[model samples]
Target: MTRRGATRNGLTRRGVPAVLLDVLLVLVALADTWANVDLGQQPAVSCALLGSFALLLRRRLPLTTFLLTVPTAMVSDAVFATLAALYTLASLSRHRVLLACCALTYAIIDFLPWPWSTLRANELSGTHNVVHLIYAVATAAAPVFLGQLVQARRELSLRLTEITEAREHERLLTAQGVLARERAQLAREMHDVVSHQVSLIAVQAGALQVSSQDPEAKRGAAAIRRLSVQTLDELRHMVSVLRASGSRPTELTPQPSLADLQRLVDGSGMEAELKTDLPEGLSPPVQRAVYRTVQEALTNVRKHAPGATATVRLHHVNGRVEVTVTNTAPTRPPLPLPGAHHGLLGLRQRAELLGGTVTAGPTPDGGYELHLDLPREGAG
Candidate 1:
């Protein structure tokens, strides 16, 4: 047999196959009917048989099955089927009124004589009949109360399972949030510490290249400066990717500002000029956006437009800060370089986050221009 078939054959809830348990209950009901039913009474025998067999339908039609078995309890002493059916109904139904009515009907039917004509008013007042009636009522209530207890236990188990799953999901989300924050912290450190130190290296290399008299020393210094700039570019890309993983905002330390624009242009290795008449005390985010825009524009010019001279212009007018980076056409063929191609996209995203816009395109004269415009107060 397959594993599923074996499981069906095996013990279910309390070490008894569900199908076997049903069959055993049916056999017990049949036995009860045979023991109590009078074979000479055709109607009584028929009702006993009908009630015994109606147990099969209890799961699908609990109320109908219970009503079918009520005739057996009314006419004969066979009451196992009626009690079983009542229990099934109570377990499945949520209506207390309906269950109470069914239980009361069973109790009254079992208490009174089968033939209405034989039940005299004086017999109802007899001590033996009163005690028997109480016993019948208690018997009928037993199965109903037991069924309700089982139903309550089942509902409680389901509720507990749901609570457990919810807690596990919350724990997973908390762990993921912690991981994201750590990644953002690491990215910030790389940007503020590693990137800054590398930029200084590149600047020193450029200075050495200019002052050194030997041609070999100048070549070495230029190579160091070029490689350092490339490393800085890659680091910037990594930082952007890492920061994107975190949903919550975190403050980045040692933020670059407009004051760093002159130093950036001087260290870019290309002939670049910075012209700005902007006022001081601008928001840090606004200054950083403008600075990153200029940096990315200069990097792209070096990569794709070799020997190009660039100009950066920054100004604030009419409650808006506008930055424009224009570069002349290349003087020679540019070298093929490896890149993630995310620089311009990152700049545009940064501008958007700060309530700004970035637009870049090639000029009619074969030059390229990038423009960034931002609100004076940045995004609220």
Candidate 2:
């Protein structure tokens, strides 16, 4: 494509007035030629008249104007004077090919000899002749100076446009980065909260199935159903807070912590012993992380080693929190479960985002152990 086609806004109506000015100038020169007047009294004024008519095409064919006007310039003083002025304006017009042609034409016409037979005998003397020559030369040079000025202005405009686009792109990237981080954080939190609640629901559902005729078991199942629905509602509300602008819900009811470990284990239909060393007024994020670590560890134990006994421990240190869950090994090594544990991956993400870590492995004592450590009092 042409360079003009590649630009976002190519030569537009902004050039219209300048072109019209060139047309008006040509008409003025034609009128001066018709008058029998010294610089005005030159013989055969048609050469000067034709040069002025040529100015009307300055915008589209500037080089043509430069080439046609030169040889005929010596015939009429008026034509010679007008050529210089028109060349200057053409330079300012910002058409490089035309400007270069003007320079070449000027050099040739000023230096090369004209045939003696073509030189007309006219009064080539006095202040009028000197002024005419000076005006012509000045006009010829005008395009060079104006072309440079126009080029400088275009370069400055291009630089400004580039700077503005770069800043806008950076701003968009920053916004997208922040939104991604927020969405990841939200996913981790939802996994922790929902999984713990679902565990309780599962236990209650199992009880309702096995104790078919027991009134107490049925009531427990009903309570479990109601609480599960309430948990779902709370989840929706919290998600709403995460999505909304200018509002955060830190005052929502506190989530479960290490204190809930015994309940979680007992609900799994497996007996568990708790050994905890927790601190008072622990930050919410740390407590949530500790609870999730134990919850997931117990869940794996229930699914894979149903008859195994489990132990949960929470250790609170000066600046960090540690939690461990272990279970007695099944008669056979636990087989892999069919569906994936999205919860386990979420637990790890939760801990890591808060500058914490987790480890899980088979124990030499024929058991499985999972451990987590997280910042206790700071940003985590």
Candidate 3:
């Protein structure tokens, strides 16, 4: 059972509230006192009463309470108060020597008669007195044994609860380890099978486009090559994301940086110009965000604004990096293309993570412009 459930069950088994239990013990002690001690014996009666009431302090000061009840046990026949105090002390205390001494003290006190100088030696030698002394020792040891058993049970329950929780945590970690391994295996398959085939398709398309005589055939081959290349790029990104799952943040394969920006623009198969005058030594995240923003903007322009020229500019100003991609009006209508439409949304999210922003809108001259601004420190 859960720890909370066990605690609730313990409370249910107890049945009586602590205050009521204390009151009940006090009443039992008082009844024992009245039955054992005579009213006329003033000193014995007073000690009996004091010990009976002292049961109320057993939970808080068990040793002191046990000591207080010793006087009554010695002077009168009343024993309920002393037994209760002894049991409480045994349950709460860990010192074997202390408990042993307390039990021995109780046994001696209960066995010896009052006014010890009167007839002690002769009485102790009698068979009846010897049996009575044995009975008193047995009674004292009873409570101590019972109290120690109760303490051991309580500790065992807590230890079981800790073991249960540790096993549950281990089970969760094992499940996650299995999932991470599966993802890694899937990533390797995609890279080896799907990416390799797409690369071959792009290469074949490039060869066909170069060798074709008909303009229409060449255009078709070029389109096929470009689309294949784009698909390969997307497949690589997806594989990287998959491999990164359940792991620490890592650099994506073919990790993009500002140095790759020129190659990206040149390979985009569009009339695009790149201009940058930014400082060196930018953080990786900042450079990556800039590269992805330019890549996405150039892709959109190629797909949606055919025959339009694009200008890419980047610079640093006021401790911030700024990037803008602007494209003129399309000379021909854009062809229908299938897209998940998450490119700009993803760019914005990446920018936000680096304390940056991405904004896109139409310019006054019937052109589209995309802008990205990032802090130089990159979310430090």
What candidate 2 gets wrong by more than 4 Å, as runs, is: 1-231, 234-269, 331-338, 378-380
**lDDT by residue for model 2 (1-380), tens:** 44321223333335445555666677676665554224443444555655667776554555566555554455443444345444444544566676656655564454333444564546346687667666645656665766566656667777898999999999988987798578657856775777566766856676685676886566556656655655666776676555553344345556886566667665654568888878878877787788778777877886788568888888877678888889998755566678576877898889888888888889998889998888886352
What TM-score number comes out for model 3? 0.59
Report how far off residue 342 is in candidate 1 (Å).
29
lDDT comparison, 2 vs 3, better candidate: 3
Ranking 2 against 3 by TM-score, winner? 3
Which model scores highest in TM-score?
A: 3
- Report per-prediction Cα RMSD to one decimal: 14.2, 15.5, 8.6
lDDT of 1 by residue, 290-362 (tens): 8999999998998889888999999999999999999999998999889999998999899999999999999
Q: Name the candidate that leads on lDDT.
A: 3
Question: Could you tell which candidate, 1 or 3, scores higher by lDDT?
Answer: 3
Q: Report residue 257 deviation for candidate 1 (angstroms).
A: 38
Q: At residue 323, give the lDDT of candidate 1.
A: 95
